[model samples]
Target: MDTTPPPSRPATLTAPRLVERLIQGQATSDGAGVRLTRLLTQDLQRRLDPFLMLDLFGTENPGDYIGGFPDHPHRGFETITYMLQGRMRHRDSAGNEGLLVPGSVQWMTAGRGVIHSEMPEQQEGAMEGFQLWLNLPGRDKMREPWYRDIATAEVPEWQGEGVTARVIAGATHGVQGAVQRDATEPLYLDLHLAPGAVFTQPLPAHHNAFVVVYRGELNVAETLVRTRRMAILANTPGSDGVLLRAGEAGARAILVAGQPLKEPIAQYGPFVMNTQQEIFDAVNDFRAGRLA
Candidate 1:
């Protein structure tokens, strides 16, 4: 893969969105005691429509992530796993298998349903990454299951003055991302910024957006967002985009935005549907061994 940064094409923004709220992730453990932080919890589901959850896990200790995620079932949603460091093997009931390595991404859509597992390929060393749950529209909830593994070299990157952005799911500058979905029109970007550098991204007025800082600190519309914190961008009318400036020490963050489905969201553990009846059906299907 070419390691050179692409040509810069700065984005223009007349009005930048402000941070509506700063969220501190709750320390949590899931998948057989693998430690993680739940940044976008259930309470904020409605506010960030089309986005269900965001979990950040990073640790150098083997005990923190050794067990890994065992067999699990999911329905009516999509999972995007971006690996920053380490290796994880994914296997699904659909017969799809992939290995996620550093800077790789696995996008799996459990449209109707699917059973899967993600286990660490390493017993020691640093493991870091994120798993984002994107809700499927009710109309397409039961379409079909889909999966894809995007290697690190396949993810497109855009370079700016002092920033490098990895476009994972939408267009950034003139570079298109590795994956694109028509319904939600999601935009996912992992940005690395040099000290005191600014990165601007123009966004649709009606789309919902947020940023999660992982390294150092960032300023969004003058609101300081520290490491491990998530900043929800306000949906102020007439706002064109967001402007992110890195703190003196530099910063790395992921910015995600998507068009809201504006549909009723009914969730039950691993199954997300449009109504209680659908949830019950999902449960029944899983119990009867029909959810593959």
Candidate 2:
């Protein structure tokens, strides 16, 4: 069956996007005491400009996630949480509250600042998800904070040719995700591929793209990337996209991309700004009760 969606024809390039670097996500704890895998962070490599941190948290043990993320404050960036298995109850200082179940996404923009808490709704089972941090441009760093919650039904899915991908943002084939923001022009998708399946996606030439493999193995470019690893795509001037193929065991992964800000990044704790003084100001603001 030729069920795969017909790929859009893009301008031919001299080469294909190649793997630039490979990062292995390591286990860590954040929030109140929730254990997770920190995939990318400013401390690890600041070169990934507009994009900040990525954490994969999943476990069957209640104690691992029950502590949850206690009341915490953030500023100067956005936080995205996507659930694959369990439920999370979230409440923010902005009077925003919601329950995120499987296949749900919550995008929180802690522009000036925000205090929020995320706790598990169920005692135990399989709790799993990813939390990503995207940096705000210098101009929008101090804007008002807000949130957008996209339920499973709201996210568009592209299924064909032994592949199913939930488009969380950006366009794939002809489907677009519900979370649309012009600032970053991001693409976030959850993908599942059957054995021997191949999938390819076109991205803007200048955009930064990466794949995080959480299950099975993937042949990215020509390199074998296994579980708990992230493959960074090279920004080849001539290349227009990336390619992937599932290994024998099949594969599950997340693809995320965004236009790079290409600006000075001053980051400290939960704040990210352009300059060190700006970071200091953010800290003072949080302590002075101005960040909310």
Candidate 3:
């Protein structure tokens, strides 16, 4: 049926743009009980479209991080958090809170607005996680607040020669992502490749694909990307799609591909909309405490 989108050669970023990692910066939290950093905010963004923000946090000593994000407010976008290890308990003022273990996924649609919190439940075991922010289209920005909590058993996984992958939010191979919403047809997969392993996945020719390396080293085209680095490949450099491989040491990374929204982006903190007035209205609504 040719349902799959046509694919083209992957494009490489300009010299000023090719990058592999983000440096830690002054820390802040979404609210009183949360922790956030400037991974893809403000000047750090624009590298990826329909995707924003990646936060990494952990509490190894237990006392330092036994606590997690307490109740907070969100609007206009979607939030997806994946647990690599440890247990995370999340609750919202909407009366929804549950624990998420390794390989599990929590997807929230803070359409208009919602208040929530995530905290660590177990003190002994390690606690580590990654959170990503996905923007909503103008038509669906204020639609409604919804959420999806998936257990480790629900998401699909594949293990092959020198590579392993966990499908968190989008499709890959033959299996598709579990969550279905008004997204930009994005694919999110956790990939672990042994040393010197090379792989390539076809992407929609009209879409953009990027890799975010968490551990070890990665090679994007001819660029060398070390741990905590991100590489963006767009416009299809060749008709063959993007190629990814591990460096001397094995590598762990996240691969994301999605169609560009191509819309004007207006974002402020937790809110993202199309126009300035909409942003103003959102601010006033939040300040007035009308968001629910």
lDDT of candidate 2 at residue 277, scale 0 to 100: 97
Positional deviation of residue 23's Cα in model 3 after best superposition, in angstroms: 7.4
Model 2 clashing residue pairs (backbone): none
Deviation in Å, model 2, residue 194 alpha carbon: 1.0
Instruction: Please tell me which predicted candidate would have the highest lDDT against the true structure.
Output: 1
- Any residue pairs clashing in model 1, and if so which? none
Sort by TM-score, best first. Answer: 1, 2, 3
| Candidate 2: stretches off by over 4 Å | 1-14
lDDT (Cα, tens digit) per residue for candidate 3, span 98-140? 7899889999989888878887778686766678888787788
Model 3, position 31, has a per-residue lDDT of 42
Worst 10 residues of 1 by lDDT: 4-13
lDDT of 2 by residue, 101-193 (tens): 999999999998999999999997999999999989889988999899998888898876788889998878788887777888989989999
TM-score of candidate 2 to 2 decimals:
0.93
lDDT, candidate 1, equals 0.95
RMSD of 2: 2.7
Expressed as tens digits, the lDDT of each residue in 97-130 for candidate 1 is 9999999999999999999999999989999999
CA-lDDT, candidates in order: 0.95, 0.87, 0.72
Q: Rank the candidates by lDDT, best first.
A: 1, 2, 3
What TM value does model 1 have? Answer: 0.97
